[model samples]
Target: MSLRANLVLATCTACVLVLGAVPGTAGVAQAHAVLPKPVAYPARGQLAHQQAMDDGACYGWARQQTGVDPSRIASAPVPVIVPGGERVVGAARGAAAGAVVGAIGGDAGDGAATGAAVGAVAGGIAHRQHRRQAAALSAQMQSSNDWALSSYWQAWTACMTGRGYSVQ
Candidate 1:
């Protein structure tokens, strides 16, 4: 496989690993944007406390009506591959291939060392590029997700408003 593709795969593998290591990462297992906090009419004091209760009620009602769980809305940050562990794998694979190719030439050991160094450098560069692309794609996805979430939030807010709670 091409170094770039390998790096990309390795990076994705690492992302999955890191995400797996995180505790409580099993909720919903899907990406979504966050809902805007509602602007309660009563800002503070006893009425405000009551408003909090109302807000909670409205949130539950909204969730029931809209099927959008606000708690699980925001998704985890996308993983970007840093140039690390992947370099070792790349170097090893390259050396093995290079050594075979070099055996046909003359000096297998020299060829293997040179190939390994080149492979490691190439892998690092590829990993960096992959990370950049992943970051860009992630940002784009987040934008789209945010838009979708806003639409859902709007529906939820409207439902709450219809139930007689001030929602913005």
Candidate 2:
């Protein structure tokens, strides 16, 4: 796996383990996305048992309407680090420039070799920068997804409130 992939996986795993150890998290098992629970009360004299049934029904209705599952979330996948072509491309560019300089100095071969190495390093640095940008984009996408889940949770709360429960 790429270094970036390993770092993200390790960070996510740590978050899951830490949250799992806390009280009243989504749960220790399958704690992918933990959502906040809105406090709810039966406003129209609903029995506790009846209220539970209504809550379950509302939960289902909200999920169906929004198509966002509270129990599990399928977030967008992170970008993969593809390895290829950069070194050769950089070397080719470097060699062309180096040959021109070296022909004037009477040492084209040595100049070309030096230029290729420098160009390869520069290309690698640029590639690393791109990988960082991709990781940032992945994070932004996940944040947007979290907003969607919050909306789904709100929908569930709305459903519960509509069914004679005071949800806050």
Candidate 3:
């Protein structure tokens, strides 16, 4: 095979691999969250009603003061584990390349099949490593976001406490 043919084969293989690896966003499921129950305040009669009103007002005020969206409190983001697409693409490409090389030995089909299997395993390993790195970064980002959220929660709780409602 000419150098041009080899380059074309390599290019096509790479294109297939890259395109296959891209993730699709359609049909993603939304996560459901269980919100914390409201704290019960001790009060009686007319005082109980007043306390209820206070709790309602204070909760709203705290949310606004802390700039925390209620929806965010309801639903936290979940990280997704991506499936590898590179394995199939790699195997296909490897087989094509192998066959071309094996043509000189008059056993192109056997060489292609063997090459494909090896390429697939290598691709799977590469995919695993990529996912590991992505998961680590995702965890770090989640930790940072959790800290910020906790800071907001603390501030909100403080505001409610200052409003004369015993906050737990």
Order of models, best lDDT first: 2, 3, 1
Model 2 sits at a Cα RMSD from the real structure of 13.3
Worst 10 residues of 3 by lDDT: 25-34
TM-score of each: 0.55, 0.51, 0.62
Give the winner by lDDT.
Answer: 2
**Candidates sorted by TM-score, best first:** 3, 1, 2
User: Each candidate: how many clashes?
Assistant: 0, 0, 0
Q: lDDT for every model?
A: 0.58, 0.63, 0.60
Clashes of 1: 0
* lDDT by residue (tens digit), candidate 1, 54-123: 6677777777766766566564544333333445556667777777776787756655665666666665
Name the top TM-score candidate: 3
For 1-168, candidate 2 gives per-residue lDDT tens digits of: 345434543443353344232223321121234456677888999999998898889889988989887666654343344434444456567766766786788867655655655565565565556556656666665676677778887898899888898988
Query: Where does candidate 3 clash, by residue pair?
Result: none
Q: Model 3: runs farther than 4 Å from truth? A: 1-65, 79-81
